[model samples]
Target: MDVRLGHGGSMFFVRDALRKLTLLSLLFGMAFRAAALVPENVVVLYNSSDPESEEIAQYYRQARGIPEGNLVGLALSQKPQISRDEYNRTIRDPLRKIYEDRQWWELGKNQSGQTLPFVNRRPVLAIIRGVPLKIGGSPLPADFKSDPDDPISKRNEAAVDSELLLLGGLDAPIQGVAPNFYFEGEKRFEDSKLSFMLLISRIDAATVATCKRMIRDAIQIEKTGLWGRAYIDYSNRHQMGTSWLNSIQNECRAQGFATVADRFNQSFPRNYPLSDAALYYGWYDSSVSGPFLNPQFRLRPGSVAIHIHSYSAAQLRDASRNWSAPLLEKGAAATVGNVNEPFLQLTHRLDILNDRLMRGWTWAEASCAALPVSSWQSVALGDPLYRPFHHLDGSGEEIERDRDFRSLVKLARKNSDPGQRLKAIETLAAKQKSGILSEAAGLEALAQGKRGEAQKWFKAALVEYQSADNQIRQYLHLAAIARHAKQTKNAAGILKSGLSRAQSFPNSAALAEWLQIVEPKPKPKPKATSGS
Candidate 1:
């Protein structure tokens, strides 16, 4: 089945719609309380061996208003990777001692009688850039045998950020992943029984400047709200992964976020023009590729872009390698990656991550809640306290400014019948001359096999769209419908027209490439045949 139609699968019934409305009301009615993450609850760790690390820590403290005493610097290796012994000796043990000395956590014992920190005072830890990124080369204890059934469980390699989550329980075996106590907990992090487990995130990137920008961007964008399109690339390789991306697509649309979902085996090609990308979730790419390769490509400020791969966060200082740092370099304020080969199931579940963020959870809260296990490979990067959707909890002017989006959200929530929803959206689009609504209606039409209606809505959207990139996107949609119908000439004509209109846009080059794909230049006529 076509991905477009697949995504637009049957809508909920009236009962489901009412239930969803009740859920939304409850979510919005709950105010952010003291249980929410605060600056006072964060302990900033920096590499005392590196001046830059200290500088970043201080900078973040000032930006987020964390208390100066909360900042702790540790003398440690500046390399991106460190030995597990070095991690335990330099990073883990010393930090634990500090927590103990300050009485940040109350010591207790688990069922195994291993002493650990059970009650927490400060529960969030922000690791600075200069700290080592991951641990390597740590052999298991001599008496410990490898798990025969789970080969991957024997690997002791892990991300330093992930390892810190277990700072309270260092005596526990670190050979296998530990089940996260807060994986899907309904209570807030501070309110949950596992509040002792630290919520750790890294404030590191390829460069100090980028790290500072990430910190500042998160603080600034949270004021107005992060608004724009969501680009979801669904690599239809496995059912589990595909379902996750599919849920993300539905959630984005239901929330009134303009979304583009690609259902191709490979990531979007380099020439694909992706604009206004405030949220990105994709997978299976080893390194950064596609539109991100274009120097002009940049995510909107405070964007949360994530690409799932085994080694996507293998290192943080090199933007040319892996997905996380490159995404940070390209203006994403937050992202998630794995420092080692975290099996597919162990990696961040993007659907859950997106849903949590949308519900106004902090970056750290959302990241941890989405993961099934910790003490493994995942690393949450960016300001741990960032709540990108906090504005959604209020009836602020920012929400009023994007009235079309609000209307669409209402349309989605109030109408469960797919046909009725599309019709109502079309009516609203016409009434308000909203390109966002027109485009959404067009997508819904295409999903229902209404090609002619889709074309009409796309044309209307092309006229109403304000941004050149959005207009170009409408043209591409129209051309795709024509091509699918075997109207090659019509597709070529649409592309040519779009190419002309896009000349002044930054995405013009990408649009031109699309034109070439739809209508390649004819081969030169064979040289005059040799004279007979």
Candidate 2:
């Protein structure tokens, strides 16, 4: 039967006047169907680097329904798993075609290029937790501070920009470079972008706001298959209430599909955390947008597992840390955080095996342990704990106490007993009288270059310094460390401010050293553009 009035098999998706109306008409031919059993075939992803990788490999076989064989190889000849294109093509593609032929709407792929299972089936989640791999195939850019442009961060930024463009401008199929997960969906490639053409039904979870595409549901993914990534899903399907997705309503901008989208009568805004970029093609039914910075990974329907990496309300970290969460959750099977290369290494390995351990059509699996090797090295995670303002000379190395703290972290991984590790952390922590463990942790974190560690310690230390010996020295210590932290304006003001408070205190040497530290690090001039 002809589903639309204008043409054969096609429907209008966007328009200008009714832009405020929640988008409708995506279900021109999509009929709501009951869910079924899990799909056959699966894709495995990895984010591991140790014995646990093999252990996860074993667990998927025994605990999860996957058989001992059928696991394909990734990361050939390289230390880290580089790409998984071959495995997806051979394994996941055939399975997706099965569902597409069946027209499973709920668990099926959406118009905006999102993957959801038939409305009622147990979705196959490709776990990628313990498979550890190197961060990127290419060397990091120079001037790349560890926190700025790492693999996950760069990808996240790419996603934000992609969603912005895709809401009304998803011309390129794939937006940025990403893990190739889509095996069988209609592959659309333009200017190096890739996209999987899928159909999105008009209805979605009540919690998903109206307007725009990118509707998804949060599912609690377990690792009954062992050492795979464990994720907490909060998409349009469920009301996790962790965070709010942004929604912007921009009327008919510039996507070539503007005419095609006129059927829905709603113009999507270019908002991140609000919509997915692939929706401009008019397939997604949900309102949330996707971060499509990388190349569009056009996976076929009913292929391997599909997981969306949205957060619950009040669960986001500071700008740097939280940005990488979605990438790891969706891409890697297992991941970890560290003073260096936190998310990619561990999760990469886990996801690989999770993908490998798929059964042709299996029952549901449970979540895995958060980590096989819980915390690795003892790295103070906050500002006050790591970056303490010691009155040491320029030659100062890390304090011995800090060294012991690191040892305890390593022991957490090695120690079999959870009670013992907790005891050890307590024993080390007992040495400090800084009220809460957070103060010492703040100083230690600062030493490691985390953003807020110093400020936390300063607030704590300020209270104690009224009684400490040589109050001026303590004040100078805070000011000096602030300089290295790149708070030039704050450091200068703090130094000048400290003088007023320390008028009668002895030992002005600390004050002089602080003055020296603040003298450098001037702001650079902006580069001239060609037009200017």
Candidate 3:
């Protein structure tokens, strides 16, 4: 009766993997087109009032080689949130004046020697460094007519980063969230009907140190490439949000990236091992508490993780609290969080975010592409120009170079037939001796109820893994295999070992939580009554 070795459960999952791979192959045929704006087209905006903000701006400019003329200093509040009136005066008016002065971009000349119109020369990207996160909504306009049937229609508030996209139209009385002109299926920036579509993002977090590191991480990863797995977790609250995550996971697969998507209503698993995560999108949680708390867990450089709970950005100074700072402290290069309870609908669109990045949009562009509101609740933190997949042309050739990618391909094909699946497992084992591939083989073995084979593959994956940062996920996976073998004590021991190793690592929040899950105290057996 020990379903621990249940054939039905294991075999069903094998068929599921094959079906997913077939669907993934079909969707992989979508065309990839490049975006219009490049790094040189961006203008960096920094607060002149805050010394740390100014320093971060200078550091970014120097590191990115952004033109000195492209740097724009603004006198604004050091506070994280500002009023609409103050924002209008300090941000809108000043930026409008600067654009009118034609200082942000170089002027083009006509054949007749006349200067080209300002519309032709506006910067497409606005890199707002160290700006306030949110702007309090202004009172409804006198002519503001709201449909009594729709409560969301009266949304007059905005995230500061989101509002800046409409800097040119700030004078107009805006309603709720501004529509994203660069949304998916729309023309790229150059071909769009709109004269301007400025993509805005910020380099900000708890301190200037975190901001500086974010910029550095972005720079490093763009060059080396964001090589790793993709994890998408959704609480399945809003169908729209869940759909976005679903699309992202598919796109990741098309690009030959390994992905694990959780469609459950539960939080991310406490002991869920995440390895070499290049991109992660999960939400509906309020704070930095979950499987992510495993101290051994850290996102790879240039990884962008967004948690869509209201007030997740309320506090960024402490890594223990809000999502943004902890993610940064845990090694994510960039993150977006809500300073206030920005409604679920207003959160960043995962599809748009993923699509833009695939199209060579920079970190700033991709981060802001799906945001529906400005001067409201959300704030983005990281280098504005970090483009993780900028070099990947979606040809799959570049992805094929990574051993893990090759292994994933083999593993995905391991569900065709008994013979074919066996061949795939053998081919993967022969091609590379990597931890990732071994772990994949181990998972496949466990799924087939081959406990001995699973143990061999998992142990092989875990051996000689010196750094906890790189092997935490492997440990967790191995522990999972142990659980399948009815070896709870062994799984607990593996988690404890990972916890010890993670002490010296950057972020180990997930490890301790994982240990708790694997080693939960045994419940006492019920005592029988004397003679019931």
Candidate 4:
């Protein structure tokens, strides 16, 4: 009755099945573990003296489910910038007492059950909500002699969040001159150094509503995964600082991102076509008065943009000229800039920031890790909880839910073998699939001059896909095919249908603009004007 296979063959088949199952299980487990930068791991800090700050913090606490114990409100000045004296008296001293008295976190336990200094139960992120964004350092006494031996003595002012990176140091007159223990190569967070304890980020914008919008955007985009293109702007000067931007291009490629890099000597051009841009990293511009200020330069929702310029965040509420506010106003989900002159060596490193972000770290974690010195000049603006790559290594089941990820994976694998690519296309098409994979396959067919076959695949994409971006892509491609076939009316109709379907898509402006070019308005009848 069971003679289809010999004993040895049956055993072999069973063993092979078990091995594949085990492998898949392991990969899925890894994906699950890498899926999130836990929201509960962040503590929200607010200024008790500022009603606006407290209100914002309360809203975030409820929205994010932060435990009551994690909410720390400090009484302090509401000024945008505070002097060293005010910082010590109103900020540092009180924060230290709260940490010690309230047992904000317990010391980490050693192997033998004794507690260790650096290791602790502290949350990884401290979000400063509603406090002054920057701090000014105290001047050395005039009679004090300059000491070449002590580098810490030469510092003048620092960012408040940067200074607080030394939360574990509780020692008097914390100099903030200590090295960033959590910088690139160091063990992150759990290491017991005072300087490496808590990473700080901020949520701020031109107003409270703007701040809330930024937070909601970060959460929404991370869930769906960021899509579209990346724009990298490199300065022509070849200065050491500007040259680092080149690394972003390489990293974006490795992350399987579509990118447009501008290495031109000039700033971002006034009429640069910045369509579908999801990421932007540029520098050397002193103000936010560049081509990006154009009304049409709206960044895709969930876009992360930053620039390298001293004092670019000097005033976040000044929406016209500062980097932070302008970027936020232009629809960027998150950004970072300096509150003062953070010299090249002290500024956050672009390469490191890019790497950490790609590795699934949240905006706060990446910014803090890349910062060479905090409490001096850097200000992270946006939701600290934003993690752009949280699902990069997610489970296959989760990957199936995202059409963009499927398309990227298909692109990466398509060139490895032509025969395999053909087989995959045929197999996917036979199943009546509608997804980015199908859309990409159709595009490949079109590239090979099989226009009719490509049109079929695109048509399937419009019916079967669920992602708004992929649906728009299918519409655009279908419209292009119609235009190539000399059917101008058909092309215009396709675009109009897409706009009707995806009315609120962030990049729909491109479709609307294209329609104007292809189908201009008809002039009014001469008889109507004359009333004849």
Ranking by TM-score: 1, 3, 4, 2
Q: Which ten residues in a row have the lowest lDDT in candidate 1?
A: 1-10
Candidate 4 error regions (>4 Å): 1-37, 107-119, 147-153, 170-176, 186-196, 394-406, 413-532
How large is the C-alpha RMSD of every model relative to the true structure?
A: 8.1, 22.2, 10.7, 16.2
Model 3 lDDT per residue over 77-96, tens place: 87767888888899877876
lDDT of 4 at 410: 50
Provide the lowest-lDDT 10-residue window in model 2: 377-386
Q: In order, what lDDT does every prediction score?
A: 0.78, 0.27, 0.64, 0.65
- Number of clashing residue pairs in every model? 0, 121, 20, 9
TM-score of each: 0.85, 0.26, 0.73, 0.67
Which candidate gets the maximum lDDT versus the true structure? 1
Q: Is candidate 3 or candidate 4 better by TM-score?
A: 3
lDDT of 4 by residue, 271-303 (tens): 344656778888767788544766766887778
Q: Please tell me which predicted candidate would have the highest TM-score against the true structure.
A: 1
**After superposition, which runs of candidate 1 have C-alpha atoms over 4 Å from their true positions?**
1-36, 110-114, 140-149, 397-403, 410-421, 447-450, 482-493, 503-506, 512-532
Clash pairs (backbone) in predicted model 4: 118-192, 137-157, 158-375, 158-376, 159-375, 159-376, 162-374, 162-375, 163-375
Query: Candidate 4, after superposition: displacement of residue 97 in Å?
Result: 1.2
Candidate 1 lDDT over 1-532, as tens digits, reads: 1112112222122223224333322221222122347999899999999999999999999999999999999999978898888998999889989999998877765555556665677889999999998888576778876545444546778888888875764444567666565676566787765634788889999999999999999998788777777888887766777888988887877676667776646567564667768799887778998778888778888999998787888888889889999999999999998887776666788888899998888999999888867678899999999988766544434645456665666676677677887888889888988788888788777766798898898899999988887898888788778867878889888888987887777666655665666688788897887777
lDDT of 2: 0.27
Cα error, residue 347 of model 4, in Å, equals 0.5
